[model samples]
Target: MNAAANAPRKLPGPVRAVGRRLPRMPASIAFATALNLTLRRKFPADVLDRLEGHTFAIVVEDAGVELLFRVRARRFVPVAQAAEPVLRFRAVAWDYATLAAREADPDTLFFNRRLLVEGDTEIALLVKNTLDTIDIPRTRGILRRVLRAAAPGGG
Candidate 1:
């Protein structure tokens, strides 16, 4: 691989500059949308259908952002206010990424208290069990390919 390809990329000037002006809500919504889309593709529809009307929050501590999503309209949608989320999960950004990237296991993380979940235990268990069956790295790879193809010059 080229050394250029190995180097880390800084955010484009426009993105970094606009990042300040852009509100948090949209980014959260977009993230939830991407996750929902990926999950829908990877899992059975009935599984996600069960989430309808339920509210869940994923808090990325390092990013200083919490994404609250309500299952509605047959899809997960981000909401600015959820009086009380049925389930809330919190983890540092890198830790969460490692879990999602399959570099770390969820059970291991939970056992080590690296991943914390709050609220309805039964619901949390249900979500956790469902997620455990998923091949996160594979799903993430596919999502990345789709996104890159959609980006300028990615083809």
Candidate 2:
């Protein structure tokens, strides 16, 4: 047996102890930080300023994946676990990836309900509209700049 399989596993709580793996906080945190920067440039300061104290949960239902992101004091904070999100959005991972990469139309999925949102409908709609209005090339340029800054000699 592999060394990991032979070890006594510790169960934290109600959740099952799926095999333990190295934590990926660095990449996730980086992604969230980059995403926040993109949001700031794409959206008005007042709109983003009002996002404080709201919890958003993005779920990839088919994959049984969940990511909890909370807006606290005008910053996006990733939570280990969250209960009763103020907003929940479910979508296929590919669709979201495509949208994020600027390869797909966010409106098509939203109109077809492939991208589902629950709770705080008005705010959600506003977010969707804002995302739709973003100029893909400009957004990509900003993101590329951010990536370059993150890496030494990356540009």
Candidate 3:
């Protein structure tokens, strides 16, 4: 059997305890990596070329997740250490992943408070609308199917 299949299953509390002991990248970094990989082809060349130095915040609340990304002419550096976000949002992890995979409607998410956008409304809209236009790469199919299978009732 695979290592995972042989591993012991723990309840939520024990799972949390184990999780706390493991080393993990920040959730934001993990999410960003997935985004970059899934949308690399759809990303405007100009945007991808300039993404390295951009400063943006991803705010996630009970509602959903919002990304506030921008490309500046100046050299890349993160400026806002504590300032209010240029873009902000909130959403549950599942809803955010669903939207990313194009399995859920952005409008429905926004209206249901499963997603909320704030900060630089114009920029936020631009980012959100642009993301809506892009499609996740085919590699996501395997991962997506696995996720759906693991979800309650298989999504």
All candidates: TM-score: 0.70, 0.63, 0.61
- lDDT value for model 2: 0.61
Predicted candidate 2 versus true structure: per-residue lDDT over 1-155, tens digit per residue: 12111122222332322212324344346546866776655666666766777777876554445667777665677766667788888875545554665555666666667678889988887777777777768766664455445334556
TM-score of 3: 0.61
* lDDT (C-alpha) at residue 91 in model 2: 75
Q: In angstroms, how far off is 19's CA in candidate 2?
A: 11
Worst 10 residues of 2 by lDDT: 1-10
| Candidate number with greatest lDDT | 1
TM-score of 1: 0.70
Q: lDDT for model 3, on a 0 to 1 scale?
A: 0.53
**Clashing residue pairs found in predicted model 2:** none
In the order shown, the candidates' Cα RMSDs to the true structure are 7.1, 11.6, 8.5
Task: Please give the CA lDDT of all the candidate structures.
Answer: 0.68, 0.61, 0.53
Best by TM-score: 1
The collision pairs in model 1 are none
Displacement of residue 74 (Cα, Å) in model 2 is 2.6
